[model samples]
Target chain A: MAQVVAVTMTVNGVKSTHHPEPRTLLVHYLREKLGLTGTHVGCDTSQCGSCTVHVDGMAIKSCTMFAVQAEGANVTTIEGMGEIGHLHALQTGFWEEHGLQCGFCTPGMIMSSADLLSHNPNPSESEIRHALEGNFCRCTGYHNIVKAVQNAAHSMAQSAMAQAADD
Target chain B: MYTSEFTYHKASSVSDALAQLASNPDAKLLAGGHSLIPTMKLRLASPSALIDVSSLPELRGIRTEGDTIIIGAMTTHRELEFSKVPLLSEVARLIGDPMVRNKGTIGGALAHADPSADYPAAILALNAKIKIQSSSGARVVTADEFFQGMFTTALAPGEMLVEIHVPASVKGAAYEKFAHPASRYAVAGVAVVVHSDGSLRAAVTGAGDHAMRLTKLESEGVSSACKGLVSASDLMGDHFASAEYRAHLVDVMASKALARAK
Candidate 1:
């Protein structure tokens, strides 16, 4: 076994501390050590965005980085997106729009979509497609996935407007 | 897939990173780890250690010194994509995707010097100056002299790329690439820049073993004479694109970028 290193990061909202081999990837660390299985590993290669997670609020492929590299960073995994009772807008969008079929790519799709919405609250159809170029959805064929993002954008905007009205 | 086990050291500063590099002769300077990590995972490169300079404040932002734009080594592709830099923003936007851009740094890309990487095309065309730091001293080199060969650079031992200095006066620049559908690696990327002197500069990437000056286009003035400037013998052929096909692409992309370069 390689030398184990102490890794500390704030995942979702809780600070996590673990000891793993320095070679362990962030995706594996999240799944194996932290037990956050929501972030899938569709392809071990970096090409697949299935392990997408927000590192310091910016989406990145988890498999491309090591666990220790994320030390002192704030990470947001799929499990952190929302609870079962209180789902995120994209989570609801995926469910309502049937954005997934086999569901292998759902976590990554939702994570990447949320990343897009965070930056550009209102993205065009082409913009949505462009943003999702890193993630692969073999089962969904991307139609429902695109619709899900569009739906989320609409709902998120509506809620923002509602909050503004309250303000 | 996991990278081979290696010692990790996070450097506190550029000098500290250089000291680490000096001590660990086989250590690799880790920036975004977008390219190096992937390569390491495949066991193509198994460095003994990784000196993490990703968080060093000395290598972290974009600033302007008179007419030169100084881009730090740790500036991520995402920053470049949204930055007001002319040809560089266009080139950076076409690299990988949003997620990859969010972590991959410009300095890492240039230092890695992947033959098919996008930034070299723009860097060469813009005549950018690369700032390199080492235990010996710090020195600046133009983009042309910096890229030595495939996966090779002008940096000597214990040296690392620290910043890129680009002229702020570049105008009417454009980058056109036929990116690989799956990997997004450039199949043939051409960057065109219209110099203030009314002259034109162009560089080619992906089609060859390294990014190189499209001297014919520069000499021919970004005109129709750029046709057949690419020689098939100088390019690499894969299943996706043949050397001859890539040669054709260089010509077509150069002209397309030229049409937009004004």
Candidate 2:
């Protein structure tokens, strides 16, 4: 059997370290080791984005990456987006617009959306669809999810403008 | 599903990686892990050791030198999708979803040599060259020469692809694919590169085990006029796709891509 090794990295703005089996997946590392279970795993194959996370400011399917591969990288899961009091624009849009049903894919969808907006603050509808193509939601039929992204874009733009005006 | 137990060695530099590879001949280089991890979980590949080359600084980023654009092997699909180079960025955006793009690397994809992959066609159309390094030294191979057949490449044992170089003279390049519903890989994809003189070159993926250039047709002086082009149906007779269907798609997609370029 292979031996486990210690891995160090930054997660959710916190420096962290852990020992994991060489075969341990990044999804398992986040959900089990780091106690951040918001990321879901719908399909073990990389086809499903349920295990999506941001590694070094880019969206990636954590299930397809080994935990040790994330060593020294900055990772952000759904848990890092917001908390009880403050909601990220994506969370607010989804909550208000009924973007989810089964909720199994919410965290991944939200995480992917955040990654998209972080790169392109204003994306067209087709671009939004293209961005979310990797993420699959079986319950909501994607109508509300698209609406949620559009709404979030507007909210984010307004907030950005407000901050710009203050400055 | 879970992966089998295996030793992991993270090499900080290219020399260290070469030493690890030389010591463990059965070791596989680990980059994005998008393709390798899934195969491991499925028990299709059970290497004794994994040489982690993801952190090799020399194997990341995109820059231009002289007449060629050099893209480090470890550059992720996300980086490519957001690249300032229009052709590279468009090709990157055509890959699977954002998550897949984030972790999948150009080197990993080329090494895997999945014929249905979009990048192969793009690289083939752009006439890119792949560079490989090992303990012995480094060697360069063209994209067409690198890919041998289905799931096969020209890489020798212990050799790792380090960079891909594309000539800057290429202009008016575009990629289009009919993605499979589940995997998002191209069922039949075509990438077309047109020179300023209207000379055209095309590469097709998802039609065979390895991406192939339509040299027979190109040599026949297939013009940008989009008239009398070969159909996907005529190009089939291979394992992955039928000749007639692929021929028809070739006509449709090639014309569409050409039109889009205009």
Candidate 3:
């Protein structure tokens, strides 16, 4: 066994640090160390997207990466997107469009979708399907998930236009 | 299977990385970790040190230099998805879902040399070249010469793959594959490239121990009609898929790809 090393990173707009074994996965660091339980660990394997998070503005499976690998990188978990008082548009859209069930995959699903919409505001059904292909939702057959992305696309586009009008 | 406690070193430059590799021969170079980390977690591989090369600035980005498109080894699949090179970008987008693409890199995939990987087929079809560097010097190896066998490559110990070079002569290309349900790896994948001079080349992966060029199919001759060069159904064999099933997919995909290319 090797000594645990200390690493520091920016998580969802906050600076945090931890001392973990070199093998400590980023997901474990987030869930156990930081106590941000919003990121679930359904499968420690990379096959499941349950532990997905944004590393340096790109969505990636946290289980596939190590805590030291994220040293000095910016990370965003589900909690960073919204809270009880205010919800991000994608969160609201998922709820309104019924994009989840059982909800084991919702955090990852929402995180991946939010990342997609950030680059492509109005993605087509095919694009949405392609974007979410990495994420698996056993409960919802993804029909409503697609609809949620569509709805969020419209919502995001409308908001952009409104902001432009206000400006 | 956590990585056994090991020292982590971030290399600031190519020379520095090479020096580190030379000094600590047991250290594993960490790229995207899409391939290495999983094995580490399973306790299949445990190195005494992990040299983190993921942040090496020199090993990132994609650009065209003269007649060749030079893609840095560390360029992420997400970066490749948006590359101005349309064919490369499309191939990148088709790789294992978004999260995988977000972190996996072309050089890392090639270096890992997984038989089922998507890029090997494309690289073979494009007739690309791989650049490798060690403490001694650098050399370029053609795609066909680089891959050895299943999870095997021509890379020497302490050598690192640095870049991939695709020629500009390739006018258009397409990659079509039947992905395995679970791992998303190709059951049998084919990539076809047409050159500006009307020449055609084909490469297949997941159909054998390593991605191979379909020389037998390419040499058979293409039609002058500029369409319907070969039927996808004719390309199947007994390796990654049944001979009959692969033949059917090959003919369909190849014909469709030919039609679209025209």
Every candidate's TM-score, chain A alone: 0.97, 0.97, 0.96
DockQ each: 0.88, 0.84, 0.78
What are the TM values for chain B, all candidates? Answer: 0.98, 0.91, 0.88
At residue B222, what lDDT does model 2 achieve? 44
Clashing pairs in 3: B231-B251, B232-B250, B232-B251, B232-B252, B233-B247, B233-B248, B233-B251, B236-B246, B236-B247
How well does candidate 1 score on lDDT at residue A73?
96
lDDT of 1 at B233: 96
DockQ preference between candidates 1 and 2, better one: 1
Candidate 2 chain A worst ten-residue window by lDDT: A40-49
Per-residue lDDT tens digits of candidate 1, residues B1-262?
Answer: 9878899888999999999999988899999999999899999999989999998988998999999899999999999999988789889888998999999999999999999999999999998999999988999999999998999999888999999999888768999999998999999999999977787889999999999999988888855556897889989998999999999999989989999997
State each candidate's clash count. 0, 14, 9
Candidate achieving the largest lDDT: 1
Q: Over 4 Å off in model 2, which ranges?
A: B196-199, B222-241
Write model 3 residue lDDT over B157-236, tens digit each, in one string. Answer: 98999999988656678787777777778777777788767677777776566788766556653442323333344443
Q: In angstroms, how far off is A142's CA in candidate 1?
A: 0.5
What fraction of the correct interface contacts does each predicted structure contain? 0.91, 0.96, 0.89
Worst 10 residues of 3 chain B by lDDT: B221-230
